[model samples]
Target: MRASLPIERSLTAEQTTALGEFRARWAAVRRSTTPADRSAAEQAVRLAYHAAGLERPARIVWCDSPLALAGRVCRASHDDGGNVRSRLVDHVRRRVASLIERRVLRKVLVAVENSVNPADPLVTAVAEAVIRSVPEPSLSMLGHLRCTGLSWSGVLHAIIAPRGFASCAAGPHDLSWLGVYDYLREVLRLHAETEPLCGLMQLASSVGWLQPHARTCWLAERPNLLCGDARDRLHQADGPALRYPDGWSVWAWRGVEVPRWIIERRDQITLAAIDEQMDVQVRRCMIEIMTPECYVALGGATRIAEDETGILWRRNWLAADAWAAVEVINATPEPDGTRRHFFLQVPANLRTAREAVAWTYGMRAEAYAQLVQRT
Candidate 1:
């Protein structure tokens, strides 16, 4: 007979109702006589328990039928019907107890991770107790450890960086542990008071000596501040630093060499230019563009094919060269005398395709418009 396990935590009224439903279903399944029907019913019972947030025991003893087994055993041993039912109930209790044990261990692991001081006597005692309770640690246990930040609890850990762990080992220069706490508090206060996307690049760039690591750390901690599309732009390598619509710009990495053009045009690349280029492309192609806010709503200067009738400008081509390979396509004229238009074709793999198109179009339009206005 399997030992009965106990529930570790109290269930709410809703969960209690769910558990009762699961028990009734399980009993019905166990009473089914047809082999296929019994098997399917047993599966339904397991699913119900899972829906109630209880994991069934991995191994369960299969019997022809609980009543049949009990009758045979009672007949052979001369036992009463009451004793047989008690033993059957014990099986169900044991399954519940196993689930509770798993839940308690998970709670203990979470408590350990959230503890401010892992060395606290109570924390250490509880952690050790949980660790020792499992006879042979399963992969699920290891997965839990990884998730709860306890995977390295008993292992030697190291953080290897090119500059060594000086900042963490002895703390950063002029900044003690308490001082770092105060600095973070100030940062958080400023972040809350000001617009989320404003001044991130400037603040990170101004943090002398810490510029390289500051941006990475800040983004990691407050990821919710930037939209997903805007955040992804920073990961590209070839383009000039991108400026987000929210007024945040990419922070320049320290100790890495950058092209002169990127440095010169860093402040010139704007989201407005990108949007304008996308607008032009949509108009030229006569194709509806899906604007998911991920790719700069597609606008920008593109290279016109030699046969196209559109105005060709040297300045537009030069600007386009800075971002992606552009080629124009000309199509048959429309009945209204307006020619069917095609936008510039840019290689998809170019990291700066979106930005380049935007910058080029913006520059060309601005230059030509200025000339016309002056004339």
Candidate 2:
């Protein structure tokens, strides 16, 4: 449980210059004459930092108000009428101005979750308003789109287990991914200790959030001196650390490859019956497990290993299943000299492993020989 991740080296000249430019632009935006100019400048900051080679680092910073325009424009419907749209634009302008002043580094990705029922009129209206004010190809839209073809287990499990998402935006925040893990683990343990007398909760959700509209967000700032091999090690050492209550879950998918195992397992874990749909895609997989201990742990489908062809089995409070494929995207050296392996475990009876793996990956038994190979 204890480990020391090496501190990354300093920034490159190009990155140094990029950061300098970002600062200058931000300063100007802070002094801008109008909201429109300010919002435009904010967008520029995001584009510039992302364009640079910054990877996931520790802590992400940004001003919520300034990025409002980009948020609003992207969510507006064409038929929502010009007045509503116009208001969204103005909101964006004001928000952008404030954001520049806040000095939020562009190296962070922001997610807003609607704590209210998705159907709540106010929630919908706010979401719409935020969306309407955003710039083209809204950040949220891009992030969600990247999640397409991924089952809920794929998304949520990845959030819980360690792995890199293919389309993670930005870098790390104040709490390194590993730090966040410890934080969550402690929070979960404490929650199980106290709370209502309804028995100890065993999963992630057992840790309650103070905010009603709870969501998680991710940011990956490329640390200096961590690239190529070292970067790969860093990722394996600190993959997909979660920051809960960010209003949405965010994964920093950098230098991480897809393992066929995870994809295959997903096929078995899905809600669809074996013959319910063909040439179909599975959206979410839910499993419930009843343990003899009277402690139930929910398992969500997950993408586990980068080298293998199976889904990582991930368990959280929502799942009731005992065993599942949790994907291991990265590996870190342990205190006893053993590698601290991170895997996405998916729910499966021992008998179902092969079928689940095959179904998800679409590979023949002979082809799966490697997966069966004990490392």
lDDT of each: 0.27, 0.27
Clashes of 2: 94
Provide the lDDT at 59 for model 1: 28
lDDT of 2 by residue, 180-236 (tens): 112212322322212221111111111110000001111111111221223322112
Candidate 1 accuracy as TM-score: 0.19
Highest-TM-score candidate: 2
Q: Which stretches of candidate 1 lie over 4 Å from their true place?
A: 1-232, 235-326, 330-336, 340-375
Per-residue alpha-carbon lDDT of candidate 1 for residues 1-375, written as tens digits (9 for 90 to 100) = 997444234434553344344333322222212222333333433443343334432322232321222222222211110111112222333444344345345553233223311222221222222223223211123222232233354121211111122121110111111111122123222222222212222222122111111101101011111111232222223332323222323322121222333334444344443344443332222111221121223444343223212332121323442333333334666788775434343433333323334344664434545654686
- Model 2 residue 199 CA deviation (Å) reads 64
**RMSD vs true structure, all candidates:** 27.8, 22.7
Candidate 2 local lDDT, residue 259: 26
